[model samples]
Target: MNIKQSIAIIALLAATVWFWQTQPARPAPRVSFKTIKGANITPADLKGKPVLVTFWATDCPGCIEEIPHLIELHRQYSQAGLTIIAVAMHYDPPNHVLAMAEAKQLPYAVALDPSGSLAQNFGNVQLTPTTFLLDRNGRIVMQKVGVFDLRDMRQRLQAID
Candidate 1:
């Protein structure tokens, strides 16, 4: 094959690998979430329900954009045993997170990771809007680092539920 054709094939392969689902074999980490409303949550506490833990910062535009969608998802699936947690990054000030959560009227739990230990436990997540979708068994079935497809998420939730 010519050089250009070979490069195109390599690029296609790279894209396939990049977009592949990341289904971690390990069970959900023994992490704890301290919600802004003074609620304590542990992974064990969320057993038998699907959970979405999104690592985001108040200053991240993408994160801000997804707030509405996240809220919608929670409203639709919460009664069906889906638990969503929006975790503010360690760098995001608590006041800013609280204000934004209140302004948006987030129905899901809003958590703070001040020590960044929660991020560290979740594969050292450093990117804003990194989301992990866990099954009822606490196994990570999906890990998306950017904007996730709403339709795809809904389908996955249905299958898991």
Candidate 2:
């Protein structure tokens, strides 16, 4: 090949690599855990329904602040095929999580990630209130790192419905 053609091919390859690297991350990773309610929760179980997976810690004020909204969302969309799973961080005491779950009367499934495996699967979640919204096909449509916008989340859930 000519020198000019070789350079052109190299340029194309560089562009391709850049594009690939800059692409957004894939949807939620596939993993399963048993909820505190003694039920197994997994991506497959949530198929055909929109799901909101939230990682939280009992000591996190922001996480605590979002509980009511989450409860409301659960009540509002569960019948419309929305599933909400709150996973407590590994550092959180299981008893504390259970007590909180009971005291709050949480309406949805609550799981304790004592191994943090579930959090790592969802991008090494190290912050409380980290959340992922997945569509009916199990593809993550949104990922919030901190406190999320309740109105915005509601709208997104409605869109999937």
Candidate 3:
């Protein structure tokens, strides 16, 4: 094969890999949330709304750093049918979670996964600061494992009706 042909084949393979990585979104998992205020929010109640679900821990620096951004997201999008749920990992102490939520004045629901079932339900999430962005139809459009891109999130939020 010629040099140019080899390069072209490599490029085509790379493109195909990238395309497969962005598979079609899957339906939201069947998990319920118990907010710190003792309110229960089921997947049924969250339908027809753009939902941002984050698995976080009090001790995770990345998770803590994302708090302000999450709060702002809630403030800006809550009225427009956006539901942000911060699910605290079962390993985190409830007292620490409550204190963090209160200290930060988090505007969104802070759910506690006391048994880690919620995390398992959300694809056995084991990393802190993992985020799932769901469309209005309850299909997860994005699942990010680290710090999420703010601009991307804003653009996604704008499309929800």
Candidate 4:
């Protein structure tokens, strides 16, 4: 092959490899944060329990829309060894977060990540209602970036225990 053709082929191969390597990795990011309830939670806490860590915001319609589903998921799966954590973002103040949790009658544990600590740790959180499903070992299994369908979520829960 001519030198020019050889170089072109090598460049093409390199680009292909780069693109393949840049794809998102399976198992979501790991982030640890304190719950608004003053509970110091870490990935370690989830080591023996299947954990659903959901990132949400009060202003996001999609996030608000999923509350009932989340509550239901917790109620349904609690006996099955599932832990549902609602991590509300946008530091709306501790009292406000508590009040909202109370108003919603949120069945699962709820926390406010006002400092963005959890979100930043989770990586690339560009939308509300980002949900991470972690296995009993605290390893991320699924990362859903938008609203989750209840039926699909229920099925995923079933896969846990």
Could you tell me how far off, in angstroms, the CA of residue 27 lies in candidate 1 after the best superposition?
Answer: 1.3
Model 4 lDDT per residue over 1-161, tens place? 99999999999988875564344435545566677667877766666888888888777789889999988888888987898888887655677678888899887888777778778878756578888887776667777777988998788777867
Model 4 lowest lDDT segment of ten = 20-29
Comparing 2 and 3 on TM-score, the stronger one: 3
lDDT head-to-head 2 vs 4, winner: 2
> How far out, in Å, is residue 38 in model 2?
1.0
Error of 2 at 42 (Å): 2.5
Candidates sorted by TM-score, descending order?
1, 3, 2, 4
Alpha-carbon TM-score of each model against the true structure: 0.88, 0.83, 0.85, 0.76
Residue pairs with backbone atoms closer than 3 Å in model 3 (clashes): none
**Number of backbone-clashing residue pairs for each candidate, in the order shown:** 0, 0, 0, 0
Q: Give the least accurate 10-residue stretch of model 2, judged by summed lDDT.
A: 17-26
Evaluation by TM-score, superior candidate among 1 and 2 = 1
Candidate 3 Cα errors over 4 Å, as ranges: 1-21
Model 1 vs. true fold: TM: 0.88
Tens-digit lDDT string for candidate 2 (1-161): 99999999999988885564344546668888789989998667887999999999999999999999999999989999888999999999999999999999999999989889999888788888888888888888787767888999999888887
